[model samples]
Target chain A: MNHYIDVRTQIPRARQTINNNNIKTETEGGVPEWAIIELQGLIQMKKEDQSGPTVVGDLHYFSRNRHPVLILGHHVLNGKEVKLEQPMAVIEKDDTTSYKVKAIVKKKLLFKSRPKPIISNVSEKV
Target chain B: MDTCPERSSEDVRKIIKTAKLHESELTEVTQILRFPDPSKQNDNLKLMLLDDNLLKEIEGGNQLIFKGDPDENAVLCTSSKTYDIKEAETSNSLLLVPELLFAASTGLDETIVNKSVEGDSDSSFDKSNTSLNKSADSDDGKPPREIVHKDIISTFFTYYELKPCKPRLSKLIKLLDPTKYRGPELEYAVDKSKLYNYEALFDQIQASKAELDEELIKIQAIKIDDHYRLLEFDYEFRVLSHMLDLIEENSWPLDRISKDVTIDSLKDLVPESILEAMFGFYSSESAVDDGIQYYQYKQDKVCQFLARVLLKSAGKFNLTEFLQAWRDSVPEGMTTDESLLSGIALIDKTTTPQVVWGFAESDLPEDINQRFKVLFQTKAKWTVDEISPYIQLYATEKLNVNALLTKYARASTQDGVRVFSAKHMK
Candidate 1:
């Protein structure tokens, strides 16, 4: 009837992962921490019936720039690196009370602007 | 591009090689050729608001817990703070990208590539376009381009946002009702399971362990035989009244009351631990003389308890008479003020004799509307000062006492004093 979620147990595991000198990023031992890709509204799949796997869009960066561009069909979405007002920690609820932090994402990839069509695709090709 | 869909394929892009341009469509950006992960990760996943304090707690390896009964809403807790967990919905969809490099990481030396490059931009085109070899120019730039190989793991539309809240401890009072500590002799008659220890109560109550412990002490709950239990009011009054008599009989100054002496005298009435806990509850350390801790009896606390004992059975007392009896009832050198009676009792100034009634705030209904309804029913109108304490318990960080009143009650100025009444006068 009552429950208490324990986040303490995950701390030691997180520390253990950090202590392993060779492993720089989230490796196979743990659930890789997820960064948020915030898109305005929902990802409306064109084929609502396609079952196996859905490829929503193609995410890209022009040349070597840090700005991210997502191409959905012919529409291109231009989004910038927005620092999160408060850093977000992705917690995966395990069993009952055990919650583990996968990663703390300091920023998010926000695509709120209207998706512009690929007019730059042909024009920008070098 | 295929007419059926431009992209629908297995996401086996974990191997490190070089980038491959897909289709005749020309673009210069490095593509993150990815697919939805077949394994579902959204069902059990939930996002939490992390402030700096909470971030430090997670990093410091302190215990953070979420507590709730099956019927009650959940609350999150750190070692010393209690917070309400509210599932806030967002209009935007947040996609979960596991092991995806951030903007800061774009400059890093190591990068993962999807396919290999063998020649210049023109010679690298593979004519046969299956799912595997959908490639054109591989080496468009100097360094072999890196394409991210990862799953769009999940998406979130809502998150559990936390705001600091008072521990919902009214639930504890209910749970310990059946297991009141009458005395040591009747210990076996009481169900030990019902009298929950800290861990057990922690599971049942929507509160942090520290807050729970504080409330237990506030209500004079003492751990008897390993389980925390509230003392029966009548029995508590009896022991406290006896303890009060010792103050006059011994003529000990309030500040110099000895802990050892008090416990030694009351040891026969109840367990020494219970007396010690009560002493700690009613007194604060004033000084330590030769290692013996001297405490000042809390005037406000003692007066309030004494007044409750007087008012509990009397129900209603003439304002002047009640004040007189309360003053006489309290111990020497301790002053009793009307302000101390804020939540416990109310004076009906509108009445001819102005009778005072015992109306404990905790005993009132928890719901906001119901609480207002009862308050208005008891008295047709209440001044802002009179109504605030009763209603402030329902106030949250997002909504304060004023906001709560604006939503639920009708306010009007009477004799230049703003008074609150039920919204619907009928």
Candidate 2:
């Protein structure tokens, strides 16, 4: 059994700026506001994992206190490309749950830009 | 004018000091006080005027000198000529004590001085009524009257922080001026009662300016605009200067510049970028986010903003004391506490045990550990199967019900039934 879930958290990003010909670094921005991170994917529970309520063949979503596992929206990935409605990380709950499941997206739609017209009339016709 | 029997040289000097008489005016008044009247040939006049020669000589300068002077005579003397002593005494003007000068100069009645000096108990009410009548009678559309600088300062011990503020001084002039201090007709008329108090106010302003001059000598003044300027490189000065501009632009009177004035009210007057900079100047982003938005603003911005306003408006308010009071009175992290408490209360009141236990079982083990022990505990012991519904029903996240129960309660096996008791100690 597989289930879908959403996880939201904050991700730290390095922002750079130049001050008086010197590079300045900052951990946080000048003003603080809420940041929402979204993750969506199919989760399959491990058979041996017994910490929480997951049973074998059951899929679940997970969020953690402190880890930035993946930022998987439109950016390139190695090995196999699995397309998701939103970015998600493959959470290996335990060694038994780790399976060599390959996800190859036929078409990567998240990073897809606006498609150009097939034909264009150059004449200035209203 | 009745001859002042108790008048001494010290008394004469005090009048000079209080009125701030010039050198020549001093000479003239001295001669008048020291000389005896020659016009009165009576024995009483002879006894009073011990020095008849000096009296004759002073009588030569002006015919206004009286044989009998009032106990404390405050003569209004212009540079060229003195107003008739008889005329001054007979006029509706209040006796000019150094403190009363501002009141007289501003065209405000002496009643305020009387009210201030004598407690507002009873007599002042009558005096105020008379003052109102006087103001009504004297309501000619003229500019506020001028007074000497010495008259504006009060004799009491007080200090003004922003005394020499040019913008404030100009605004004050406008506020006191009968022609410019426009308001509702009733208010305008009522304020006119203080016309006699203008001289005292002017004296205060002048004293403030003098103090400001002394203070300015130690600091640098940077002109920021046509009407505004910075007096020091310090952050306090910067904030104060900006605050003064806001008060002036808004026409907030000294009494109206209170701490209750909201930061939102200043939104249009002060830019958000400056507020952000000021906030950043003292606090970090995370510190601000850890509290409620409004509480953050008050804790961070209230002092700098209020100090400036109070200094400009009331000419007082110690910054440290104000801040300490604010901290002591306001609870820390109240907003966060309120939010957490409300959330817990809502859930506890509306939700069932099964739902709460499921949430606890799934992702909030710690929360359940804290709340469930207090909420579900009773004298009777509950079996594992009896409590299983609460832990498993509506639970989406994977959780071990048996293992989690051991964390908060004591489990015992009796007659094939495993029972859990919250009060059972390990």
Candidate 3:
């Protein structure tokens, strides 16, 4: 059977474990601190008769306390971007050293490109 | 007989003074004897002095008597001697024995007593007289009023005089009494035929009530439906009328006649396809002596065909609501390709109306027309990859893509496509 890895769950778990002790740092002075964690997860897509597993996508992560955080790069990765069927999260053990992820894998479908939002001219004050 | 004729004056004076002293002592004794209890002494004295009975007792004494008739003569006997009595008499010849003196004094006392008795009788008579006078004063020609002992008594008498005496429950007893002829004869006569048809009358009333209720319910439902329909129609009419008006004014030809048979004249003709595409764009562009008119003419033709094809689709949906939303999305002074695209996207998201995609250039806003022209050229080559981003942007921003698509598609075929050829192709 083919086993699928939930990229959303793996990304947050890796970030949480890395930022457990280290304080967030910022690139510019006077700017609020932000935490960035690069997560790489190997998602496998196995065929029914194939003996080996095929990698689907890699997971990348970055976060800030406030502001719009970009989760995925604009470019496609291997003909696909890391997308999840459902929102997922990582669960940490009481000892805080290890992590376990919980996720659901639903039926996969072709991903449509996110449309570029049009910028409309703001209407003049009447 | 009377040998010793008279005593000396000095001896008579001495005798009178001694007798007077005895009389005072006897008077004191009589007062004491009258009442043994000293507390009642005043009462006893008043009785002896003032009472006629005491005087009468004194009159019965042997020393006092009437000489002739009792009623005519008043005399006193003194030691068996008689002396006349008068109102004013002062004479030594009237001297008498001490017992006779006391008795003669009693005679005067009796007269005083009799006068006192008469005075009392007069006083009592005055009291009775005053009472009688009061009774006579109270009589004012009206009947004597009797005091009522109880309020019920007065009320009963008043009710008796004012109204006929009858039992309070007479009517009720008459209604229930078996002795009285309280059967149908005494009751209001009901028609037997009407009573026999009671069930039919009841059925008729029930049927009428049911019909009334149903009619009321229908009226209420119709009122509500009409209210919503009016609102919907109002919005529909506003948008549809506005679109038609704008198209007719800006898009249609003003010339009444086609002057020349030229390629330019062909351009002036409105495309039938575009006309039939939607109800709102029918009069947008006018036929003119220009190449754009040919596109308009062709568009009219295409629109006509689309109208037939989409009649069922439009019927199933509220085209009025869709048009209103489309018109509202296109803001004022936003006569641009991007604006039109945004309006189309809005309509698509809200109304989800089906449309064909392309571009056009006419006597519309210059920048938007040019953009459409550019996009049309690119779309002709089926290079959607280059235009997909713009389309995506238009879609995401909720522009009226349907209008843009129809307008642009007509503009691209304006040069070569003929209405007759397009009709055959469809």
lDDT by residue (tens digit), candidate 3, B1-426: 011122232332222122221111111111000001223212100000102321222222211111222223222222222223222211111100011111122223344346448763322323333544243332333132211110000000000001111111112222222222112233254223222122222122212223323432322111121110011222223333343344344543423212222222222332222123223222234454445332222333223222322232332434454344434433233222323332122112233564323222221233544555554433343223233334332332234544444444432333464211111111
Q: Give the per-residue lDDT of model 2 (tens digit) for B356-376.
A: 111222222324555456435
Interface RMSD score of each model? 9.3, 49.5, 84.0
lDDT of 2 by residue, A1-126 (tens): 212111111101111111111112211221111111112222122234322221111000111111111111111111111223321111111121111101111111111222222221332110
Q: Docking quality tier of candidate 2?
A: incorrect
lDDT of 1 by residue, B180-283 (tens): 98878887798765668877777777777788878887777888778888888877887778777788878888888887888898899878887877787788
Candidate 3 DockQ, CA atoms: 0.00
TM-score of model 3 (CA atoms): 0.11
Evaluated against the true structure, the overall lDDT of model 3 is 0.24
lDDT of 1 by residue, A59-89 (tens): 6543234567676655667787677787666
Cα distance off (Å), candidate 1, residue B342: 2.7
